[model samples]
Target: MTNPTALELISRSNRLGADPKNTNYAGGNTSATGTETDPVTGEEIQLLWVKGSGGDLGTLTEPGLAVLRLDRMRALTNVYPGVDREDEMVAALDYTLHGKGGAAPSIDTPMHGLVDAAHVDHLHPDAGIAIATAADGEALTGTIFGDRVVWVPWRRPGFQLGLDIAAIKDANPQATGCILGGHGITAWGDTSAACEANSLWIIDTATAYIAEHSSPEPFGAELTGFGALAEADRRAKAAALAPTLRGLVSTDSAKVGHFTDVPEVLDFLSRSEHPRLAALGTSCPDHFLRTKVKPMLLDLPADASVEDSLARLQELHEAYRADYQAYYDRNAVDGSPAIRGADPLIVLIPGVGMFSYGANKQTARVAGEFYLNAINVMRGAEGLSSYAPIDEAEKFKIEYWALEEAKLQRMPKPKPLATRVALVTGAASGIGKAIATRLAAEGACVVIADLDLAKAQAAAAEIGSADVAIGVQANVTDEAAVQASVDAALLAFGGLDLVVNNAGLSLSKSLLETTVADWDLQHNVMAKGSFLVSRAAAKVLIDQKLGGDIIYISSKNSVFAGPNNIAYSATKADQAHQVRLLAAELGEYGVKVNGINPDGVVRGSGIFAGGWGAKRAAVYGVAEDDLGKYYAQRTLLKREVLPENVANAVFVLCTSDLSHTTGLHIPVDAGVAAAFLR
Candidate 1:
């Protein structure tokens, strides 16, 4: 086979990456050596095939492997002299980019060449990293694996570092594996399968040994402050804090994904020395490349009000950026890569779970997974005594390394609505959930703004994987809450493109029997709530100078009132007119405000909750059981007008497919003749 070693390396890496306990998507790398016949020369030439950078080993294939001429690659060893081998390495990776490929091989390629074995596998197994980053790692490594493994002190991985590894292995011929202090472990053998076996053996044995020796704690036992609070208080605090946090980190250009803190994370951060421990840096360089040198640790008083927390969060944003600048200034020299913005990749909030930020959901998720893994490793290392990691100087080497940053630049372009932010009122369930789900499905980062923060969170979770949604509590009728919801959308996704007013209610009451409270309730949510949300969203859209959408969920009752539905009919009529007026005003600013009027939405709606089903059945003179079927059969197409159906109409208006069409209504009631526009 032309590159069997490449295939074998891909296979072995995938095997190691099958479980998170072994290795993460972008951590570690593997390689194998063999010879490939030169196409033109017709002579055999040595080749080294290594896993390409930023590829997940779990699903890796031969196409993802990088092949290099062994003799050419080997000749570069010890050639770069004192410090900063990045230039030489980048050039080498470029020279070795195989098969008209776009990606460079893993930066650890040169190190793999030093193994002096046919196969080499480098992995950041949970147990391996935990042990490797532990205090006095060398002695501990000696005790655990004896002479079979060699320990190399913390050294930034590059061409020179590769030479050092080879030198150490050359001297200690019997050591079949090596642990790079505060990093990860490596194993090698005569064959790919043998190397795989050695890697598993080292990781499994270390894990077992650590478990037996250390007093095991919960996964996040180290985190504390947030976990100590009452459950209800914690939920409220997290909701209050998330939006402000999202806003601070978001710039006009980029909005990072916000990860809600979990109970485990709260317990872990509750640890007394968490601030210092957090700054100790990542267990592996790969993680630092994603989460940065360390997380931005936010320590807030547990009893602080939302106003105080908001002010504090803003201040923290400024301070974090300044600190990041200082760090970059200290480490960045003449030949170093340009520095990135000061926005943090991860934020540690006391009494709340951690907030991680990334430009996109995938980037955010990768960073998050690494932090969780690091926590586990750090916890184990601390139990053994102290946790140690590479210094900031070494960390800079990995962070701005052209190879490391290039992996991101080389990523595929984002989806069209990938950068847009959206807010869906009443998103905890029903029509609101359907709209939120559709927006998220189409790649818009969404905020599930509802009265029930917990339920909003659940709805966001149910929208599916990828950190595309975050829940924010907002009573739509409350002006301040509506503003907060709008702010959350702006902050979480950078800018707002869509604001959906889907929160509504209905009650069956005759004109004479309609109570003042009933009229107030209908008008407050449908009219006042829409105005609050639209005004807030419009200011943002105008300020951003980007066209956006303000969509309202109107009702057929606006034109064709149902008997004994006086309060519902009046509000629906008022709301429909409000949408038209707003559309006319916003059209001048490129913002499209429209409405979807559906007649019979008995299913997939919160309005039908309680006795509405019974009330609706009574109005139509049908049994409660026949309500859905009756509505469906009466519709023009004999179909149920669903929440999803309403959501689809909203999607069209927001996408601007009907860019020029606004100041209108889209009927989703399956052809109600009386409700149709003149």
Candidate 2:
């Protein structure tokens, strides 16, 4: 068996784009320009050629190849929006190559250019697509190549994609090829034959797996106990789920269009078991961010009442919101605000498929995609044999993760809170500063309200050059000032989606030394101040019917009352309880209330600085630094807690990811208190 030559490998690569069984006219091309060394120095150099956009790789000839200088391609990364415009990319390619007549370069030219290898081949193989879209794609890849493969999540192909590959190359420095999720694969090597062989190997692996386990049995046979519903009954069920969904979704594009042509839609919707439909996802994870974890499961009874259906939907939505809030609060750092919202959950009418209500198209799309993919994976896994998705704790970690949250913060498309207003109290430092910074970064017009107006302004200015942060002077405990501040935030940001109640003081006075006046002061700042802010935020969160987060920064002292701090400890305890009561009462109106109880946060602001740290240190007969060391050593993880650690927890609780959590107190104490309690 003779090995294929470089020209033969290029021919095979070009032919892959034309295979209908693989990519169906999604535009693919391949190219090969022979090596070119300096004429004077005789140094080894490579001249690359890529297939033009409209030219089919299968039929591509030398004329279809666009020759270019690899050095010039590498330099384009410095240009503004270099990867954004296709024309600019092509124009840049023209500057380096000398060719009489060759096809345009492949859109993936920059990616291939980054590879140090002599030969590169790019293809969107059908088998690769199947594996990439599978439920355990990442896990599957790991099993296939232990450490040889690198996976890149889906991103629009071109300059940006090239830059991403370049970074990966720099990191790994020895990677063979890269797999782009939901897109395709690229293989490169010292020679064209090696690159082609690698590409063929990946496709062969995926193909073999698909052939062995492509089809799995369904979840279950038709419900034997419950009789199948008639066509009219199915339509009634669909109607019942639709109106509630109307309230939850912003657009009716996916809803208005009926699945008259798709038999799967009709068959699924007609089934009495509505939960089964949630198993199908659109295609990928990016889609899930727009949709949700899951869609509504509407089981329409033959004689079901509209009110009953609506009530059920409302009940589930509330439950989900509560769960989301609780997750956020638990994982949030000390001094962060709580998660709040109404209708973050969406409904998928049995017949309607999926519908979501977000502030805009991108939000709706994100929810739709997430819900779709999750459902598909869940259902597909069920077919394979009763597979359960990751647990709530794990899901919460991903959904409320700092890195994931940062991604959203970085390239915010359109969000519900993009144009919305927000007010953050205690914004001068600690958790309050974090919340203010996050909200501003996410495109919200924010008002930083604090007792120390100058400190608030300084904090705001430090975040960014933009005037997204407005510092206002207002004692959160003062009713008049609270009202005026809320008014100011609303007037400044246009509307509100969040209010962080994070102002308070703590005093470590033993019961004997704790005066009535001292207790009142602690209660006024922590408890009373929270109420004033909530009452003020309610006007906007409720009146707008837009729903919002009301986050209270309580203390871990609330959960584990330390010795000689009766006033501060009691106030924090009350704040946690208050959140539960508020969640129950305000849940009906779409307002979410939650709290964070962080332990062992270093003294920077609030009660920790106002003699409380010294007093608590005195109880242990240690200096303040020693107290930190004591707490750090006592924890299971043996890590000192930082304000940012607490800030991370607060950020998650307040974000939309934990849309279902509310009415809970999360301990952000690095497991110290939990160890003690246990």
Candidate 3:
């Protein structure tokens, strides 16, 4: 086959990266060297296209690639200021741009460019790392591939490591790849297919060899009394402890969380070797950067009761923080990024599972995933021989490396609601849907709770993936359902920070026309529902010790004294007061309660669509289509209040702009005179 183009290089990367066994998220790089017509010179020029810094290969596009002149990149070898000043090489790479540089070049660029091959792949496959981290890794590499694949000793990733690998290939002309000691593996070939095949061969051979030489109990046999809890009990215990864990972790910065109870994790946790191996921490730089230098394991056994675990968690968390701080102090030199918080990103509960935290749901989930990769590496290494990860000092150097710090600094500033999770009731449509969408856009993971399960799920999909929004079936009036919804928020995104009590209906009935059932239904859906949702949410908010928001979506009819709105008006009034009561009660816990009063949201309103719009239109002696216009004309602003307008109010009240304001009702009714707060 002809030498692969940049697109084929991306295709190969996507295939290799799609599997967790091959590489963890954003953990590897792939490149192809090809001649392209120079945009200015109209002459063929050799360019290297590789996966960009901080981008996942599976989702990589042309724009996500860094294209650099291969000649300029190779020329970096001469000017390299040795390993002591290796970091300067990263900045020096910027000068090698082929054109208007695409994505920023990753440090791994040299690994791809310096190799004398048309195609190259650098991956952190668990199997390869398992071989790499084994105490006899160099000998094992020779035995596994019989000189077909070489072994390169541990070296920090930079220009030097790249040159070292290139030298290894030069010495062993028959080698297709090399196992990176205490790291991962790299492969190269004349074509993309050949390169990919070589990578898979290394990974697959390492895996089979380990299995062939594996011990029966790699983690030193599962402890007799240490096993996972029953499924229901496990979930309950996880939910109960999540809020406190979230609170402790978020002390420095707010974090969304992800929980996993996969069998592999449970099995590893149940083993006697878990504590020792976990303490040694993960081996790969890709793994530890996300999982942290090491995981914090609950000292208690798997069989410990939830209450006991909860009581012990605080003490353990404090100890972990102290230990982490010491680690930082021991390794941090002057100008090192001031200890990026002392909290553990991965929290291990033997019987329960793992809880990982990050700035958002996807990040939190990926952290957990990286930990799982670490687990597989441990399994393979211990099964083959003693697991020998790089020393902590080396790990610390990589963790606090200036290049890593620069990468962190380059991340965009987070949105106001980043790391926050909101549950908006009645979010399947209309006002509730609008609020959910807006909050997600502002960086909050939203839970779309509605009576209609399908619609709620559909709305959530429309907003984003499971990380951004989730759908939960809830009839807000039901206490059990309400609690379940709150618990869903906790499990889905760690804990809840915002609640919009928007699940409501309108009953346009006069005092004489309204039946007792009508009053009960309206009050049950709005007033009682808001109370139920708030009560459930407050428990989490208080437990988290993270300030929260509970906004009631009341109506203008609550105080405007509109005709034919007795039941709905009374319910709205009750909802409005509940906000004040909650604000007063939850203030000590830093929970803010507020309300939004929107008047006659006719366009795209479930309440209005459910016959209320026609009833109000008939009452006002206007066509149904003209109802919004009629309502708008009456307001001082003479503008119809859209569902988006109410959503905007919720966003404002939840942001720092109103951090000191509570028990307040913002009118989203286009300047309604009668609905004005007194």
Question: lDDT scores for all predictions?
Answer: 0.77, 0.60, 0.91
Compared with the true structure, what per-residue lDDT tens digits does model 1 show for residues 521-609? 98898888888889888877775556778888888888885689988888888889988899888888888888888866767667787
Query: What are the RMSDs of all candidates, in order?
Result: 7.1, 20.8, 1.7
lDDT of 2 by residue, 2-99 (tens): 11333564476555655543332323444344556656678755567666544556666556566676666667766737533543674576676654
- Between prediction 1 and prediction 2, the one with superior lDDT is 1
lDDT (C-alpha) at residue 355 in model 3:
95
What's the CA error at residue 185 for candidate 3, in Å? 0.6
Model 3 regions more than 4 Å off: 1-4, 39-42
What lDDT, from 0 to 1, does candidate 2 have? Answer: 0.60
Write candidate 3's Cα lDDT for 1-678 as tens digits: 222597798788899989987898898999999998877989889999999999898888788899899989999888999988989998999999877748999988888999888889999999999999999999999999998999999999989988988898999899999999999999999988999999999999988998889898999887876799998888888888899999999989889999999999999999999999999999899888988989888988878877888888888889999999999999888777878998989999988899999988988999999999999999999998899999989999999998999999989999989999999999999999999999999999999999999999999999999989999999999999998898888888888899999999987778999999999998899999999999989999999999899999998877889899889998899998998898899999999999988988988999889999999999999999999999999999899999899889999999998999999988888888888878
What RMSD value applies to candidate 1?
7.1
